[model samples]
Target: MFGIRPSQKVLLLWSTPVDAEELQAMVGELKSVVGAEGKVAVENVEMLADSSHAGSHFDLILAGVLPPFQFENSLNVLGEALRILKPGGSLIVRTTDSATTQSTLKLTGFTSVSQPEDASLTDEQKRDIISPVSEITCLKPNFEVGSSMKLSFAKAPAKPSANTWNINLTDDDVDLEDPDDLLTEEDLIRPDPTTLKVCGTTGKRKACKNCSCGLKEELDAEDEKRVEENKKNFKSSCGNCYLGDAFRCASCPYMGMPAFKPGEKVKLAESTLQDTS
Candidate 1:
C-alpha cells in the first residue's frame, strides 16, 4: 500500500505489539519496495514519541503499520514523524479512526492531509488484515522548518521625487529686513567696565588674589606710572639718596632706598614702603 520507490529511505512505525512473524513480513515487504540501494527502518511508535530521530532522514514514513492502529499520543507521534521526514516527504497512516487521525496529522504540521479512497488491498488480503481500514496520506511542507524566502510578488515602496517638495516662496512670505535692524539702542551701547565683574566673582571688578583677568596687571601698571611721575619731580634735600641707606638721614624720604649710580633712576621695592615698626 506504500508507494515507496527504489533507493528511497522508509520508516515502518507501529504502536501496538504485533507477532514477530507479522513484523518480519512487513519489514521484508518494505525492504523489497526500497530495494538494496534503499534503506528501511522498523521502530516502535513509543520510541519516536519519547525521543526524536535525526531530522529530514526518511523519504517516506509508514505509520500505524498493523490494523486497528490507534495512537494514544497521536500529536507527539505524528509531530516527531514530520520532524524526521525530509522536506516534501510523504507519510501514510493506516488508521481505524480516520477523523481523529486526519485532525491530528494536520495539527502536527503535515500539509495535504487526506484519506485515500482506494487502499489497493485485495479482498483476501483485506479479510486477513481485518476490514474497515482507512489510509490517510500527508506531506511535509517543501520548505524545511525555520526556512525563509522573500516573496517575488512583494514590491518595494517607490522613492519620492525631488519635484514633489514645495520650496518656491512668494515675496510676501520672505523677510528682507537686515539682521542689524533687530538690535535696540541699548544693545549697541558699550557696557561699563566697573559694572562688569572680573572672572564672574561675587563683587564687581573684585579679581581673585592670583588674578587671571588682567585687572591686577592694569592696576599695577597705573601704580608704576604714578611712582615714576613722583620720582621725576623729587629733589633730594639730603643729596645722600644716591648713596646706600647707611649714609642717608634717618628721616630721609629715600631712607629705605638702595644705593645707586648718580645718574641712574632708582625704583623702590614695594616692601621698603611698608611701616613694619
Candidate 2:
C-alpha cells in the first residue's frame, strides 16, 4: 500500500479507457487515506513522458498497469517521473512481470527497488491477470518459465539540505577579536569634498550623499540649488527626468504607474515619484 500523507500531491499515470476506473478508485482511496488535504492528478503516460516538470515535487507517482507498447522507450517515462519527483518521493509501477520491472528500476537509478511477496498479493490480483498484452505470451527478457505478475516500488533518495555543512575546527581556528575592530581609524574616516569628482555635465543627476569619495555637506547647497531650478523647468514626464523621452519608466508614479481611477483599498506611495534609475 502507498503510504500517502495529508496535503501531498499524487500523480496517477494510466492509459485512456483502460483500467481508468480502477486507477480512479485507487486515487480516491488514497485521497481518503490523506483526508481533506490530498490532491490527485490523472494523466496519460505519453503526455508525461515529454514533460519538463523538473521540480514538481510529487509525493507519489502511481503508474497504473501500462502496456509495453504504449511507451516507445521506457527510460523516457521513467526519467520524466524521476525528474519531477522530489527527493524521498515514492514511485509504484504495476507491470506484467515483477522481475523485469525490478531490473529496469534498479538500472534507472531508483533506490530500494522491491516487489511484493506472494503473501502480500491481494485476492483479486492473485485470481486474475489484467494487462493489454497476455502476461504469459509477452516476450520479456529473463522471463522465468512460470513467473507471476506483481507491483514494484522504489524510493528516490533524499537530498542533503542546503543549510547543512560539515566542517572540522581546531583550537587554532578560534578567533576572539571583534569584527568591528578589524578596521583602522583612517579607513573609517570620510574623504574631503574638495578633492572628489562630481557628475556635473549630466542631463539627469543623482542626489549626492556622504560616501567614501566625498563629504555630502559640500554638495548639499549645490544639489538644493539644482533641485529648485529643475522644478521650475519640470514637465509632466517620467520622474521629472529627461530619460522619459526615450524610455518609459513603469515604476514612475507620475507617468507610467497604473492607478485605479477611484482609489481602491490602498494608495500609491509618494516615494514612487522619485527616479528609480
Candidate 3:
C-alpha cells in the first residue's frame, strides 16, 4: 500500500455495482489510511474511458476487474487512467489475468511496474467478492505529457515498381552520341496546365473529379475496420484535422502542435487537401 498523504485525490473505477454503503465503507477505509485530516472523494463510475477527464488531476486511480479480453475497452480505460493520473501517481488494477494486465499496463507507458508482494485486503475478503482479482501497481512518470501516446498499426509492405522504360540496348553496341539528342523540346518544356490530364478539383493527374484514382476502393475490409476503430479512438483529433494521431497539423509546428499542448488553436484555415505536394 502506498503511503497516500493527506489531501491526495483518488479515483475509483469499478465495473461491479457498488451501493452507497459499500462506497462509504471504501471511502472510510481510505480516510483511515490517509488520516482524519485528509479529504477523500470516491466516484463509483461504471467506466473511466471518457476523454473529458483527460488531464493529470488525480493522485491515485484504483480499478477493479476491467474486461481483459475486450482489448479496445481495456486499452481505452488504461489510457484515460494514465491521462488523468498525476505525476508519480499510482495506478492499481485488480485483475484475474496478471500477465495480460501487467503487459497492457507496461505497453501503456506505466513505469516502475510491479505486483505488490503484500495484499491490502485479505484472501477471504477477495474470495468473498464475485470478481476474479489480484493486484498490479504502476506509477506514471513525472515528466511525461502522455498526449503523445499513439496507436500504431503495422504498415503493408510496398509492391515493387513497374518497369519505367521499354527500350532495350545491347552492351556491345558502341554509341558516343550526345545524351541531349534523345530529348525533344516538348519533353524539356513545362506542359500547359489546361492541356494536362490533371483533375480540376484535386489538381492531381492520378485523382479525377470523380475520385477514380482507386484510393478509396483500394482499401480492404480490414483497412476500413482499422479506420473506423481509429475514428472512435482519436475522436478528440488535432484541432479540426480528422487524420489519425500519427499526422501533425500543417498550421502547427512539430513541438508546438495542438496535440502536445492544450489550448493551442489551429491557426491556418482548414484545407480540403492538407497535403500540398
Best by TM-score: 1
lDDT (Cα, tens digit) per residue for candidate 1, span 1-277: 4778999999888767566777788899889888899999888887875655689999998877565454443786777888889999999887667777888888889999885444555554577664466778899999888789999999989888888886899999998999899999999999986667455665655557778878878777878888767655666776777888888877555776667888787765656544365
lDDT of 3 by residue, 1-277 (tens): 4557777777766554445565567667777776765555554443455436648888887776233211222666677778888888998776656778788888888899896343356554656655355677799998656346545785689866686555677867766779899899988998785467555576664454366645435444557678556534443444534333456554333323334345443343335213343
Every model's TM-score? 0.55, 0.40, 0.44
Question: In angstroms, how far off is 113's CA in candidate 2?
Answer: 1.2
Candidate 2 displacement at residue 199 in angstroms = 84
lDDT of 1 at 187: 98
List the lowest-lDDT window of 10 residues for candidate 2.
Answer: 132-141
lDDT of predicted model 1: 0.77
Clashes of 2: 0
Q: Lowest summed lDDT over 10 consecutive residues: which window, candidate 3?
A: 64-73
Clashes of each: 0, 0, 0
Tens digit per residue, CA lDDT, model 2, 1-277:
4557788888777765465566667667877776677777777887885555546467777774433312222776776776667666777765555566566666655676654333234556555545422111111122222347755665578898899897889979986799789999998899975445554433223334324433345466787788656644444454333333245454333344444333233333556434344
Give the Å error, residue 92, model 2: 1.3
lDDT of each: 0.77, 0.56, 0.62
